[model samples]
Target: MTAITQLSPRLLWQFFDTLCSIPHPSGHEAAVRQWITDWAQERGLVTIQDTIGNLIIRKAPTPGMEQRTGVILQAHMDMVPQANADVDHDFTKDPIQPYIEDGWVRARGTTLGADNGIGLAACLAVLADDKVQHGPLEVLLTVDEESGMTGAFGLAPGMLQGKILLNTDSEQDGDVYMGCAGGVDANITLPYQAESVPSDHQALRLNISGLRGGHSGININEGRASANKLLAELLNEINKLQAGIRLSEVSGGTLRNAIAREASALLTLPKSANPALAELITARQQQYQQEFNGVDDFIDLELVSADLPQRVMTSDLQQKLTQALLACPHGMMAASRDIADVVESSSNLGVINTETEHIYVQCLIRSLNDTGRDRVANATAAVFNLAGADCEFDGAYPGWQPDPQSAIMQLVLNTHKELFDLVPNVKVIHAGLECGLFKAIYPEWDMVSFGPTIQGAHSPDERVHIEAVSRFWQLLVRVLRQIPEDKAASFK
Candidate 1:
């Protein structure tokens, strides 16, 4: 093991550092799966690998605690792979270079994967520690949770034997997540024919970069800028110049859960208006800098001359595409009246691309309530249809409804107070979690989620709080030790 793997928390950091060294991007997690299986076998823990590659490791209770109830500890093994555009790191084979920065462990120029990696590390640490007291334990490590919930959805009906489950995927340390928002992906496509460019026109590429983007779910309501929206805004200004510009191509965003930070467009304009267009772009760039001065200080817009044989999109198609994008909603649609600070409904225009056959756009819609989710999705589809585009929605996952009377909630509250002087805050999150899928599979199971402090998840700014990991470890151990035998029997 390397020095980084041999750091404090011994087994925990070792597993984490090893995980960071391996490349486990969403659909490609074969290497990580084999490593986990080897680790479990070496530890003598009873393990089973599902067809979808989800691993379930079981450890029988200590001699005297054999009669205690079985508890399921759950976390996803995959992460949202993201990095700065200028960084040359590849998620398929590069190791994340994590280091301490301002009290947080962050990667050099890529996402730290602390969102679920820390949760998985905590479970490994607990299983390796023989000194920690606990009942029969089952650790569930899921795959491809960042891109989709495919592993969770493929879990068999009777795969797990535990009646109580503890999810370790929450981002905040003290927040107990009992419920989460349900989400659906709406994919829209608009076909348009391309035409040859006129020899008299000049080609220019317009670029938008350096915006501070974050997780679409967590930052949707924050009013942070989106590159797709910024591009549309710039086009709207360019149209004012009336330079006979013809849009050739447009593309932006990579993941559904990440906010778009950069976008580029190729266009052709009459040579007579070259000087006037350049002046307009410069002035608009400065205007935007002053407009979002404090919030997005690094935001920039650039235009450069380029040459192309053929025009990507015809003038008619470009007009329709730009109008549709600008008409589409791209931010919080509604706020939770029930919860003062929670966002109830929101939509994110995650991805956009222009191709020879069609123009495609992907949007993610989220809502705390089922009816509200449908409403938002319907509204979104209406926008696309109005713009003469065919839209389809898929990958809809249910939300975990908050249960105030849950037995797990009581245990967590009591255990937290006993471990520390203060009680932990219990609430629901606007983001989606695997707990929602698990609840649909086993409605009788009681579930609660909590984790260490992780910042800038789903973005290159991702980080993990160094101190919170130890505290989180301590809290998990305390909770396991306090599960009374009588209470455990009641569930069975």
Candidate 2:
């Protein structure tokens, strides 16, 4: 048993510790799935697994509680895999080293997986707890929520038995999420030819690191710098300045859902212009630092020597690629006109790859409405298309629409008020969630998402507050016990 399991909130943390000991990054959920399956079997509960690894663990209502409405406790089983560049632990082979620090539970150097892990553990605890009361219970544990909503996408008709879903994948403690943004991924490829390096040219590598990379959806409004965008700006400025620089290689960002934290590039320029190029990059770095002030206080830009290549990108291709990337939007394309301070439409230049054949750029566009998402996607495609690149969009998912009068929503609100003695903040999110995909199939399902307070999700600094976990557990317990009776008959 890990030290975390022995903490104050022992039951939930115990399951969380077991989860951290297994390998379950995105699509790799086999081990954890087997363990949980055996756990349910050992308890003599009925368990069903779908074709795509979505698990349903069902327990009959506790004595005299069967008439209460059936509740589906939902959470994803997979986690986003991320680590500090310096961390040596392999996510696939090693258990996350979680420890308590200043009242928070954090992993040593990798993502703590608390975003949905805590919620999953909470479900496990509730299943094991005889003291907590509930109606006919169904736990719908989906898979691959981070890489894509694959499990939710594959959820077949007639598989789920509940009309009410309580998604525990949300991050905020007091906030109840009713709706979320729909999103799609756009790929832009620009074919290019290499040209011989000019005489008297020096090759230099420019690297930008130390950005507080975060979830593309949750952190879109934070104004944190996108490394891909910043590097593109630098390259575009160098081209405009006519510093005799030629692009050799460019790369940044890893996943389409993560905001880029670091970017680096190779360029060849006239030997004498090296000093001027460095000075310009330094000035731009200072400008960015000032612009980001408190958010990205330690943004670092470095210029160093790199091995010379026989050929570099042709000047025309270099300019075209740089300009297109610069023209492409990176953040806050639009805000909600309906809800105050809630983001409606947004985009993330999530990844860029400069290879021998072409430079590939992938972007994720999100919005509360399909029309808004299409509008921004079309505009982005236009930018790359006008620059002579082929643009395509796919992997689209629907958004959850808010129903303020939903029974599940009102029940959660009342339960939260009773537990915390304060009005719960209910709002919509600008990110994608499995709830959206699941809602499309089960249109009659009433859904609400809430969880413990998790900070820095999808990044190495991820952590869950100790106190908030207990409170969140309390709210879920109370809400499950208070489910109305009429909905129970409807869950055939």
Candidate 3:
């Protein structure tokens, strides 16, 4: 039996175990979505599916709580799909084998999916609970939240009957979230022609890996290195030689929301320059290790001989692409003035791919301030434009403005104080959340976010604290019972 099956609130852990059996990675949530619907129907709960596959399971309040206001419990149904290079797990077929360790729950060589899975499972547990004294309840399980907010973006108007939204997607147990940053996706494509490699040159593949990549927006302030940027930096250093070389392929980073942990490039180098190139790569890796100091210092670089390629990028195209990537911005650009040590604006060079005719790069830009996001996006586009690449900024989402005076916020704060004997910190997150988009559809809804303690999200190191999960459940139960009678009646 899994260790989680022995945890408290047996129903919650049971549902979480069910989640582990299904592979619901971002954009491929059909199987999980159908399972959730069938499970809800089996229990006689009213289930509704939105156009984009978002599920809403409505549960009538416990008899005495009917007069209270309706509340919405929201969470994403998707998880980031990532695994160690050496792990042979297929996200579409392999189940996440999570285990207990040192009071934490982690998966073997892959993400544990605790980022939002715990939240979603909590909703299911609540529905199954006969003891929960909650009002008319709606569990909003959305899809594609890891890669984008498509489900939230397509939420139907007037579909939700609740006015108080409890977003359970937050990652900290003792802290509550009142607001979150907005984000945009930028894609740049540069056309290039490939030429046949010189007969005398040798093909070499350069790789950089072993980075501790976390959520781009959440960890952008951490001075962590980006594999994409590191690869480009190496290429730029080599470009200075002005020697004849041809790039066959260059790529790294998987998702736009994830900080790139690995990158590699296939190129043709002069047979005589292999010795110097190897030495330069070694030195560069050392410099990067020192640059990061102790954090993420396990940076690794590998240079290996490869088979000859038929085509390589033309010299002019290679030069321009290298210059553009070097000039591109990656990581935090501004700090929050209102919140100390909090990031206000940042960008992640999350993906890079070299194709037959073009090199494509993807960036996710996040900002609490819309103007700041626009400024950074414009700067990013300018860099590619000057380098003759076609760039576009799309999929923009707005930020959630904090409302400290809201009734739900006060209720949450008071509930935490009662449970923990201390006031919980209320903060705005730099990461993208679906709250802002939900507000667009239902402006009348008041929202607050909180969840169990999850660390190293969006990476294979992701884990959830076991103790925190119990506390989070207790807090949620208390919050459901304590929504003031006057406030509940006011929503109508």
Best by TM-score: 3
- lDDT per residue for candidate 3 within 1-492, as digits (tens), equals 477888887888888988988999999899999999998999999999988899999998888888787899999999999898889999988899999889899999998899899999999999989798898899999999988888999899988898899999888878889999999999999986778888888899999999999999888998888999988899998887666657888999999999999999998988778777878888988888888878887899999889988889888888888888888988999999988767899999999998767889999999998999998999999999998899998899999988866789888888889899989988898999899999888988989999999999999999999999999999999999987556633321
RMSD of 1: 2.1
lDDT of 1: 0.83
Tell me how candidate 2 scores on lDDT.
0.89
Task: Evaluate all candidate structures by whole-model CA lDDT and list the values in order.
Answer: 0.83, 0.89, 0.89
Error of 1 at 179 (Å): 0.7
Task: State the TM-score for model 3.
Answer: 0.98
TM-score of each: 0.95, 0.96, 0.98
Instruction: Give per-residue CA lDDT, model 2, range 280-383, as digits (tens).
Output: 98899889989999998878899999989888988888888888889998899898999999999999998898876888999999999999999999999999
Candidate numbers sorted by lDDT from highest down: 3, 2, 1
Worst 10 residues of 2 by lDDT: 483-492
- 330 in model 1: Cα distance from truth in Å? 1.4
- Where does model 2 exceed 4 Å of error? 488-492
Better of 1 and 2 by TM-score: 2
Q: After superposition, how far is residue 53 of candidate 1 from its true place, in Å?
A: 2.2
How far is 177's C-alpha from truth in model 2 (Å)? 1.1
Candidate 3: worst-modelled 10 consecutive residues by lDDT: 483-492
Q: Give the per-residue Cα lDDT of candidate 3 at 291.
A: 89
Kindly state the number of residue pairs that clash in model 2.
0
